[model samples]
Target chain A: MIKVQQPEPYDPLSQVPLVPPPGHYSASKLERVLRKGLFAVTAELNPPDSADPRDVLKAAEPLVEVADAINATDASGANCHMSSMAICSLLSRAGQGSVFQISCRDRNRIAIQGDVLGVAALGVGNVLCLSGDGVGVGDQPGAKAVFDFDAISLLRTLKTMRNEGVFLSGRKLTTPPNIFLGAAANPCIQPLEWRAERLAKKVTAGADFIQTNYIFDVDVFEKFMETLRKEGLHKKVFILAGVGPLASAKAARWMRTNVPGIHIPDRVVDRLEKADNPGEEGKKLCIELVRQMRQIEGVAGVHIMAYRREHMVNEIIEASGVLADRQ
Target chain B: MYAVRLFCTRHARAFESVYKGLEKVFLSLHPLLKGIGYNRLERPVAMIEQMSKGFLFDCKMCGQCVLSSAGMSCPMNCPKNIRNGPCGGVRDGGFCEVRPEMRCVWVEAWNGAKTMQNGLERIRVVQPPVNRELKGSSSWLRIIREKGAMKEASKRQLDPAKSELAQAFAKARKLEPAAVPLAKEPVAALAEQAVKEQTSVHSTQETTSQ
Candidate 1:
């Protein structure tokens, strides 16, 4: 029988019950990662559209052994798919670490609160609070977008829930989610300048760690890190620069044009366009970004955002050489 | 009732400029269009607005036009019609989780707002849900008649305790007036400070226990 602690004094790490509850994941690998001083690698795991647990495990198989934690994206882009919560439950049940994504795009306050309790109950550890993708860009344009709390607010909310052991409504929780809180940053995104300051804001809102948007422009990412360093924001949080393998030069160019925050330099596109094997070149570039990001001062880790094609994750990381001391 | 408070940012300044420019043209043409009052061009105007906006920003003509607030992207085009920021479904490279082929509209809005110089205002404002009655209306006239600012343009009163929109409004109200627009970052700093204090206290307690 699991005993719930009373005379409740909330400690963020008191998440693990004193005794093992039947079968459960060991610990939050992502949490044990010492910020700034240590290097870690996490991968984005896109949950399957089906309810099958094997499908979830199969998708996670590649990175599970390598990544410190695999992010289970919630209904990203407001498109329907498997829920991030389910993926977290399944992954933890399978003894894998997960960063359960909680988006403000769909759930209201009540739902968000319930999910926090639910994840905690399931023994899930890490959570990435996102402002969520706009519903206007999703498959269901007709559905109402719930910005119950934007990323910043969600971070604050989760922090309060854990520390105060109370809901945003001032209601107490029998057991608070002892999560290692994380928030996202889009360093490369425009107005081209406010990105770093925004990251600082995420850290300010109680994000212990940050996972950024794709880092296509090394110069832009470097500048954002510089801003964080200048502000001493680097001392406040662990920043993991986001990196992904681009498909081709054409895709890179298309992304620069049609995509909002992504900015691919002309030279990279030209490099891809000129390459006999653009796909292979893209992987090489991905490796290069990882190595370069590691050299940056503020970046403590890397979050590999490999959408749909997660199979190549190990190969890409191996090529990047970021797995030197990863557990 | 959803109270969509619009905090004016640099993008909103551009919106004001466009509104004035359109008003000048519309006022000059109102005499001409109204001269043929029986055959008003409302339908044609709506169609034109719909077509041009659809092509440019996929405008949904949600009578309370948030184009400027959303960096000229039509909030209606989003599956959830979220105005404040993005959802978790913001896939890699800003792809829409719902429509992998498409780019997330909020992502575009963030870029647009940034490019347009609404730096401090990004993700700070919370847009209220669309009023179905205002569908297919001219944003030009709506701006002139009701909300001088989108913040004032909200049509309903919200209960903060009961709804998310109300809670958002309460939070936004606590920030400095939108004129400063520098309000959001400091508030974020305060929240961060609180967390820091709590963690330090927790560590001290753990040490004492040991």
Candidate 2:
């Protein structure tokens, strides 16, 4: 009988300290942003179709001073919105810390490379690469998708541009951008054990930070953190729990009925329904959730996503006592 | 007499299979040639061996790893590895550099990753540069294909019939005879038949019976 010898598991981390090829840029900005730990806060600002960046800029301003950076949504919710890069540029010009959301849905490698270069030129240092929402969910039903590269590929491309100082085509860049790279996660939706594995993959793929989907239950977030700690990934990367103000009763109901990935608990629903004013009640509930999440060890920070109720961001942050030390 | 030695350092399995198949046919036709008369055949065999080794080095550009990780096709074999390129000559889906059956590595990788569970979401995260170190090390091929003498053993036997027979024998050895109750086996068979009959009757009643 022949004895089978099991090979060692492939450890990507074992190749740490492998320097990128000469002439490529380093993702220093991403490293710096994660290390600074100045209680980073970012808000989502969707772009408008028209070249006019009025609404986005206005939406971004109030939170600009308080937030370390503002995250502009790229055709958020699968709608035919304006380019996130353009809006991010406008926000950066307005002196707001801008994090540009680059989705893989609209562009191929050429466009992604070009856009990354363009954004860096504009001095927008933060970038989040997302495999954009499916075209089916967008207003433009028949719009074609041009997924030339996935998120990991985009990350690899960016890493190449930064470290190798060249695009995927091997063309050298004149001036590489100092960009902070981030990715998203949904801990509540997936099986508890798999979340850490997925997060580890993202980290291996070079994601500096993770912005999670809206977190309604702190217990689930705690479980996620426990899993990360158990897997020894808790200390490796920064994770910002997503919290959003539920807005009106209709909005709460809409989120429950419409949002596919988000999990809004029945307890939250019952609280919203029982309150005389659903908006205020929802806001209060969100504040408590954030406060509980903030207390969890290994939590880097919280990203308060107020959905359309952007104004309540200040309230949620204040109520959570996150602003207590800063003020 | 000049002696020629043929060596296949890589992809030894497939190459050995072809060599053994040809050897079998040759021996069948000329049994007397096996003794020492085939020393002259070594030169042509060595040339064929070299050609096969060179051919194995040509990248197939399957992009399995690329698709699983990046959502982009592999550009390892493509001259440009253009994320969005036809180069004006990519006909149907195959690149001009490779076979028609092989689609553009990048396109196929993107499609495969997109279909995997949570693959689309993971695709959103930015990827690091392709470790061209993957090229320098012969490790990728080494990891996929069996190596050394084991690979030679695998190639020598093209069919799995003997292995199948051994597996069947092992299974038969593990099997234990069970005492069956007189009514149990017949009753179970009757129940199965009854269910099948019921299903047929239900299907017939639902259809027009034409």
The prediction achieving the highest TM-score against the true structure is 1
The global Cα lDDT (0 to 1) of model 1 is 0.65
Q: Where does candidate 2 chain A have its weakest 10-residue lDDT segment?
A: A1-10
Which prediction has the highest lDDT against the true structure?
1
Cα lDDT tens digits for candidate 2, A1-327: 111121122222343322222332322223343475645456666455676678777777556545666788888656876778777767655655667887776777677888887877665767887765556556785877665565655665676576567765556687666666777776765334345555676676567777877888777878889888887776777787788888666676676445445666677788788899888888888888777777887777777777668877765676576645554
* DockQ measured for candidate 2: 0.05
Taking the candidates one at a time, how many backbone clashes does each contain?
24, 15
Query: Top DockQ: which candidate number?
Result: 1
Query: Model 2 reproduces what portion of true contacts?
Result: 0.09
Task: Compute DockQ for each candidate against the true complex.
Answer: 0.08, 0.05
> Which lDDT values do the candidates have, in the order given?
0.65, 0.53
Off by over 4 Å in 1: A1-27, A254-260, B1-210
Local error of candidate 1 at A240, Å? Answer: 0.4
